[model samples]
Target: MRLILLGPPGCGKGTQAKLLSRRLDLEHIGTGDLLRAAIRNTTPVGARARPFVDTGNLVPDDLVNELVAERFQRTDRPSRFVMDGYPRTLAQAHAFEQVLAQWKLPVESVILMNVSDAEITRRVTGRWSCPTPNCKATYHVENNPPRVAGVCDECGGRLIQRADDNVDTVRARLKVYHNDTSGLIPYYRQRGLLSEVEGSGSIEQIYASILGILQPQGG
Candidate 1:
């Protein structure tokens, strides 16, 4: 099933998407990751993508649509895909529908991993990442604190909160999410394709909730 994974920042959307992608045998297409990859590669796309990435704003819809369209057409493409971090606004949603209609692959469901704004702030503030450049190894202050304070378990590098992960930046990103992305809730609801999975539980529990929604007939 083609899917859209929806949630605020720190809502466990990406974690749940990764699990569901594996279980359902679908590729996980995270637009944020795509932009980051582009930036890292410094390709023509990256060069053009950098300005938008530096400031936490959604990329232009046309470019995003093209990237997603190209991914969907790959030869070894998954049976379906779980999309993360794309269609941050209603216009992108419209664009996505047009492209999917052209491909004749309308989304089967939109999974919403619901978490509150307060929870989001709490979750992000406590999070830390590996100090290795470009390696974002996330840890938590309360839930998953490192073996040693301010050090990554995997790389032995110091752990630090990402510049974007700080309170001010997280708040800015949250404002953007609330303003632009939340509209898709009603949009998908109108299509009768939205399923909400409570986003307050262990990763496995959350994954199970998502699976139940996706394959409601229980496979």
Candidate 2:
């Protein structure tokens, strides 16, 4: 059940990873979450990564690889896992392969959630999040607006759009994604481990599609 879920920003990779991990009883290993935890815990790797993360720049490949390598080497690492956000570049992908080889943990599949740029822009730019530290409820300006304008329904906290979710930032992120991460599609496809899933449908529908691909025939 080991898998790598790949997609551009706002393509629902996080949501799908959570769903798949819960349904199959596998650990969901999201790189963003991992980095945040490390930073919060002040791990050595996190110390090295903080400068770049604070500056809104991509963490160097070496630092990211080190972080991932450390995670994979954890004594409590899950036997089965879903990787959500590592390997954002071809170099990272190669580094990840090396890590997996060293760890003797071969990936079973790489799921790419395909979505158009326009749709992604719409989804990401409309997103807003609660400002309260403990209550981070999310809403969209259109699809799932908060009960009251600019306010979180659950805690009455002000809703703020993340700077990274702005149109300009999202476009920049998408550019990087297409230029770098997209190459992994062909890389994995050539190895016969790539599976494409439509990312625009209902969450349940998309989850079902992923399950269909991962499940054994007629199982």
Candidate 3:
């Protein structure tokens, strides 16, 4: 099963993808993680993508598509994979279709994890992360606070909220998500591959909903 998980920031797309990948034995491919790995390795595509990523700008569609294509062309690529973040815009979606066609990989399901903006704000604003470079553990003030306030349980490092996780920054991200990524909802729906799942629930609840949608298709 080739699956796509779509959602706004703080919508738990990554968490759900990880769960689904483990349960279904599929590769969990996150575009952000892939870009970071490429940049760390200094690949040709990474060299082109580094500037944009470092400057907090969106990487060009062609460069992102190239990264996706490279992943698909790998000899060890998994037959089943769950894509957490890619095709964020309509143009990227179309470019991704071309890549899929070229690779002969068809998407079996696209899950849209739907959550309200208010809920997104609440979830994102509470997020805090460890300061240690290697121990990037995360905590939430409300949902999963550390034993000691502002301290990382694993590394004993101070926990600080990321600049992008601030309420104002989260709002800006929400606006961009609505402007750029929402179109893909309709794009996938028209193809009869989209499944809408309520996202404002427990992790297991949301994962159960996603599984219910995909199990019928032999996930």
Model 2 lDDT per residue over 105-175, tens place: 88889999999999999999999999898999999998999989999999999899887888899899899
Which of 1 and 3 is ahead in lDDT? 3
* Rank ordering of all candidates by TM-score, starting from the highest: 2, 3, 1
Q: Is candidate 1 or candidate 2 better by TM-score?
A: 2
Model 1 C-alpha lDDT per residue in residues 29-99, reported as the tens digit of each score: 88777667667877566677688878977677777776665555556545488888777688889988787
Local accuracy by lDDT, each model = 0.80, 0.88, 0.88
Between the candidate structures 1 and 3, which one is better when assessed by TM-score?
Answer: 3
Rank by lDDT, descending? 3, 2, 1
Q: Each model's TM-score, in the order given?
A: 0.81, 0.86, 0.86
Instruction: For model 2, give the 10-residue run with minimal summed lDDT.
Output: 70-79
lDDT of 3 at 115: 99
Best by TM-score: 2
Error of 3 at 149 (Å): 4.8
Task: Quote model 2's TM-score.
Answer: 0.86
